[model samples]
Target: MELSQKRFVTIICTYIRAVNGVYGGAAHDAHVWSLSNERQYMPSNYQNGDKSSWLIGDSGYPLEPWLLAPYRNAEENSLESLHNEKFTKAKSIIERVFGILKSRFRLQYAPKKVVKILNVCCALHNICLIYNVEAPTVIEINEERSNLALPNVDQNEFSRIAQTIRDRIKISLRS
Candidate 1:
């Protein structure tokens, strides 16, 4: 199978929050996110009435009240552009963590128990963080294309709410 066909999805904060490896590479990121147990529980666990917490997702994922995505086709030097810039910067941490995980442990050569292996690696990665272990140097590679299409603006009420929340954040970043 091609490397793209073996894609897995992971959520990371200071450490891995969730990892889903059941989907094949052809699965769209939004589809995976929509069905994830983590996503189901996010409203209860993280989001309350305050709207103080949210997960940052890439363009492949849909915008939701509990999740935020960068504004697509944002104009140059605009507030939306500024938000995307800051969003990219903040999102780099997850990429760096993945780099460290891959560099420290070779996942490509692992056996068929890939999902278990991924979970174990994530756990170990967190342990390294807790103990202050030095991370391996990350070798940057060209990012793979996502299977999902970029999200289009939805006219539904739920989507409008999400867009409003995103707009609030974009405006806040102006200060």
Candidate 2:
């Protein structure tokens, strides 16, 4: 079911690290991401090429040095498939954070200034985490239902490096 006309993008790592992109629902995820301030300034923050600071993204996102997307059409029992499995598992945390946000805030009821409201909600959520306050409820997300099979983007030099990084991680997972 479509949530709303407004599309909100969030980056969560135990806490909501970034909340951005209050675009219309029709906006492509990758397009919104490309225009995000966080994406624009990410290089400066991680100029050292820290392999450990990568972000996990869905197929709708473009693969980049700092962002890892799952392999398209990965064969069963292959290293890519194993990587996808682990990637999905790691990505699920963000999904749960969304579930908690929606359940607690009932974002659907916000009539206007939804972006500001969303930012406030994220801040409050983080504060709750800091104080060890329990969320009143959390919506259970169905991982399979949310999966999108987007076409692979044309590989650029940076994406090629990301592919190598992903391959190294995939191989390491097998050991």
Candidate 3:
């Protein structure tokens, strides 16, 4: 579900999955941002090479990436470590939630029967809270899931943009 303001309440009874992290249900709000917009806004506040800027987070739960601007001026050594620790710990709940959905609820795998798919997804969803079993890897992502490694994008343009973002951030810190 696409939310404009806040997503504290959007995490119930939905797929709870994120795709490319652009648009998704539930936990996606933490890291979701339009590069189109952020590219314009963040540069003014944060230097591109500022690794700290990458951590500016509005996740509410303290587990998400710190929003670039805030992260730039944070306690990099200790706070980053603490934030990472908390983020790792907090992510387990989401993982378990997906695990239950896939294993007990059987949502991860595709249903073969056309007539009973809805019924099955619904029934399993209810029973899942009680059964809580191993996640059944039912639905496998196609080329879509593994695209990060393949790099189908235009290398030159992508590199140029990345370098620009990096250079700009780096230059900002010198002042």
- Candidate 1 local lDDT, 1-175, one digit each (tens): 0011125655546677677777744466677777888777766764456466677777776676777777888999999999989887777766666667778886775344666687888788889999999988764433443445655557555456778988988889767
Worst 10 residues of 2 by lDDT: 1-10
lDDT of 2 by residue, 45-141 (tens): 5676555677777776666768888888899999999999998888777777777777778777543466658778888989988998887765866
lDDT of each: 0.69, 0.69, 0.35
TM-score of each: 0.83, 0.83, 0.30
Using alpha carbons, what is the TM-score of model 1?
A: 0.83
**Which residue runs does candidate 3 get wrong by more than 4 Å?**
1-76, 108-175
Candidate 3's residue-wise lDDT over 11-122, tens digit each? 2223432222223333334334433344344455444544344322222312112231112223655554444445444444444444454354443332233223534454
| Superior candidate under TM-score, 1 versus 3 | 1
